[model samples]
Target: MGTNTTLKRSLGLWAIVALGLGYMTPTVVFDTFGIVSKQTGGLVPLAYVVGLIVMLFTAISYGKMVKVFPSAGSAYTYTRETMGPRVGFLVGWASLLDYLLLPLVNAVIIRLYMEALLPDASPWIWVIAYVAFVTIVNAVSMRSTSGVNFILVAFTMVLMVVFMILGSIQLYKGMGTGTLFTIQPMFQANMEIAAVLTGATIVCFSFIGFDAITMYTEEAKDINLMPKAIALTVLIGGGIFFAGAYFAQTLFPDVSVFHVVDDTLPEIALYVGGVVFQLIFLSGAFAATVASGLASHASVSRLMYVMGRNGVLPKKLFGYVHPKFRTPLFNVIFVGLVSLLAMGPSLELVSALINFGALIAFSFVNLSVIGYFVFKKKQYQTPKQVFSYVIMPGIGALLTGVLWAHLHADAFIGGVIWVATGIVYMLVMSKIFKRDVTKLGMDAADDLTG
Candidate 1:
């Protein structure tokens, strides 16, 4: 039996990209288009443009940290190494909400898609099936997970491309809205700028999967290839999202006229192709949700494995890789079990918590870049280095911080409660008053290898 405890470096650049894209789920643009259109008043494309700009800087900051501390812990490692172990632990604690709950969100989304396809089917059935599917795929091996991601991403992208093309052809034939291209979709005459920026915040969720790429650093074949992979993932995901929103907007230029904002794409599909195309769209969407669930489950398991191996959690359980499969089998099962939350909670509530956790993690990444390069290495000695390392990260930190501050009130409360719970656990389990848990956590890293 193969007994390598460490994760194997089995993934190439494109494999990492596929994993990232799968987690992002390009079809989600259609899923959220109605909300985006209503919020932006037909300026969905512009909102995505703003989201892309902000995420690019954040992606750059992530690339910087990946080069310096390449590990599976991601934000936890970056924050702990640069700031301190205590702060790192808290960041990990907060990020746990994001990674843990995201699989549930994707699984629930799968159920939602299934319900739309077969109104008579029980949502719980789809939830159970997807959760089980995700667990089985991730428990096998990273290669198996990545292989599934590649195929799902490929199929989803082809369907999205077809949807866009058919939408364009319908618009050309003067089916609805009478024109194929119009500047109004990007900029409405009387809409407030704040509305567009708020809409951008909503759209920002679509760009989140890029940073998950860093968790694969331990398994990537070429470490340097990670930065390029991160950039490409964000670019490709953003491009797909923008195209979906733009075309949907063109087909139905007036958001106020949309009977139900949430069903915008389904409505558009009905208009453009008929019942057959709507089924195809729903099938593509369901496939994307399954792909997303698999990716998120795999990521959360790896995050737990890294933390567990570092002694941040139970090393014996979380740290143990399957001797034969070389996968974090226990961690995978743990994440899958957590995804059972899909059966209990509303999707909106879980999504709010995810936004809070992910936004904070993004802010921490920017801060890590500043802590490492500007304060530690003193890269400020040169003008070019100062701008690239210091100025850029500073802007990134500020932007992400703004986004965090503006998070929905419900999300803020949910995130704060989760963090408070972590603090309590830290103090109790780590015996903060009796022992130096922070130092112990840092030292625990010496026992393992990447």
Candidate 2:
């Protein structure tokens, strides 16, 4: 993408927020419960409501932290400031792993839906072809990628909203699941709260990237506008998540009350709305997944570049921006290659490796918040800031940790391996640079000297 000219910092608050929400548009957890009704019975929607409440509080603390420290290294920088460089590298490195696998996952998901649309189309072809397509989009200038992202997210959200409204109207006429809200099934005799929790961890990941806007500080139109933009993204994104889950529930009321996992249930939307609605839903999902795939690739590349420039990595990638677009073109290519490599495994197997890094990063942020505020109390941050930072982060860490433990073994194992890799990388970098990693980025951003 750097084939031509220089880069500029021009994205506004709306663009940044769009990136976050666009990435989250693929979170279709309600559909999952509808598929797994053998376990949750009736309580699926209730769990979603609980999750929203928990997320709102944690998001408030995250917002505070982002405003307090505006830097490119989102989680990586946040953890480093509070816990030290090693932990920060862990944050950055594991995140690198997460972003690397994203495109692969999304491409596979695209195939999953494509098969539903055209059963004759094989998934392997979809993965390979779609990966190549998204890679090209992201490798170009930010304008093209961001522009496409806006369209994908806008269309997906609008489609979901239309579906929800129509579904609600049908329910009013008793032409649907009858518009009834029943808490009775939530606590049914067979409700597997544990399984729900496990499922919820994966379900919850759909909401993860809402704060990705924080990573664009150096290039953002206004620094202070970040908090408002981020907060709005989370709120609006949550609204969509709820809408997808509840709307499905309302239409396919007993959607989760059965046990059939061979295909997505409560596909009642797809079932009732006929072939056209189903195609719209599936295509929007594909767009949402690819939008996120592209955004995450960009994010990880920028993060890798940040760490690289800070002497935290073996090479200086953070400084490697596209000469033409002024965006991180090298990082985008590297991320795409890694994603392609990960696709060698079964998509189902690789999918398990997906959420671990996210949960760990979430845990680190929660802890980092507490740790940062503890430092702030001593480092001259205000009392109000310190209190909010420490207390809220502490709670976030606790809840996140509990939630993390409930995740699948693959998630936990994937997390450990990624962390270990980060640790080893830092050790090698320390020897190469012959300097402590902690001192890398403390210098002013303007200092370009080695």
Candidate 3:
């Protein structure tokens, strides 16, 4: 690949935000409702509220960092620029669990949906087909991927609206809550705070895509527009999750309603609107998975490309961009191949593991804000600067830290192993600090703008 080859600058603010929303997968609220409902003791909406609040603060920090360093590496780039190369590489390495596995999560979801519709068919067929289609769309170009995502996101939003209407009618007709204005979904007298926090930790997985938007900085038509795009993506996606959860929790206040707590989308649809609506809702869910798969597949490839271009990985293959398509062709294909692992893992396991990496990345990005602005730039002389640089991101760091503490034991163990492996690789690459690990053949100009 030529050193001059860079990501194309074709995405505008709306396009970037659409891709971010696609990555977030709005339909996920229904998919995870039963599990969260059980975890929160029937307060899924409240847990989403907590999750959204946590994400909003972190989103602010992300917006701040992108303005300072507009690169395709997202948290990795911000951390590297603010902290140091080694720390950045470690964060990026740990983040691979979230960035890389998200596509697999989508593939797994697609398989589950297909399996429900056709129990006798081989599920691997759906996984392979979904991965291949998303890979091909992403490999084509950023415009093509974003365009497809916009349509898919639009379709999902429409279905969500229809669900809200149907759910409201059912509630008014004396179902679960028997009223749309009831606060039962948000709170109950016996609900425990600990349970809500635990549920929040799991739902944090739904907010992972907003940060991934930073991975498209180099591809944005105007880098300055990224801050708004990032904030809007979080707000819009969080709003959808909150609304969807509210309706689902109201329609079926008890977790016992779901036969499969780990996957309740089909049941929720069937209960709310019968067989016809269930079929329609499944189509929307499929569209959501495809949209998320395409967006995540695109973002992770760009991230790997950045790491490779920095000489932290096999630069020849991982860093190479196809001149004709202006996309990370090899990285796209590699991620698609990795996504095939979807056939092996359970949805709950993948969801928990994703939260582990996401929380780590979120914690570091918040820290990156302080490291860059308050400590390094010394911009905290005034009250406003102090709040923006110190207080705000500090809160973000604290909240994410709290969530990190609540991660599933299995996820924590797996994340530690991933980070340890990265440390060992960094040690070998740096030759025990004898040489630099990040500056090898890295072209700073290419990272700034396409």
List TM-score per model, in order: 0.94, 0.86, 0.97
Where is the poorest 10-residue window by lDDT in model 2? 441-450
Question: Per-residue lDDT tens digits of candidate 1, residues 1-450?
Answer: 222477889999999999999999887776667777777777888888878888999999999888888888888889988888889889988888899988888877776666666879777887888888889988888999999889988999999888878988898898556576787778767977777876677767667789788888889998899899999999989888888887877887766655556545566677778899988887777778788888888888888887877778877888789987788999899988888778666555676678788878888998999898888888888899988888898898888777676666788898899999988888886684477768646555653223
* RMSD of model 1 against the true structure: 2.2
Ordered from best to worst TM-score, the candidate numbers read: 3, 1, 2
- For each of the candidates, give the backbone clash count: 0, 10, 0
lDDT by candidate, in order shown: 0.81, 0.65, 0.89
lDDT of 3 by residue, 189-245 (tens): 998998899899989989988998899998899989999999999999999999999
Two-way TM-score contest, 2 vs 3, winner = 3
- Tell me the deviation in Å of residue 424 in model 3: 1.6
- Among residues 3 or more apart in sequence or in different chains, the pairs in candidate 1 whose N, CA or C atoms overlap within 3 Å are none
lDDT of 1 at 355: 76
Tell me the tens digit of each residue's lDDT in model 2 across 1-450.
332233457778888888888766544553354533433454556556555555665677667667667776677777877787777777777776666676666655666566666778655677677778777887776667778888988887776777777777777778535754644434556667776666556555566666466666666777787778778877888777766666666666565333434236225546546678777767777777778877776677667766766656534454566776677777777777776653345443454566677666767777776776576556437777656766667777777677677866877787788788778877776777788867766553332211
Q: Largest lDDT belongs to which candidate?
A: 3
lDDT of 2: 0.65
Judged by TM-score, which candidate is best?
3
For all the candidates, what are their Cα RMSDs to the real structure? 2.2, 3.7, 1.6
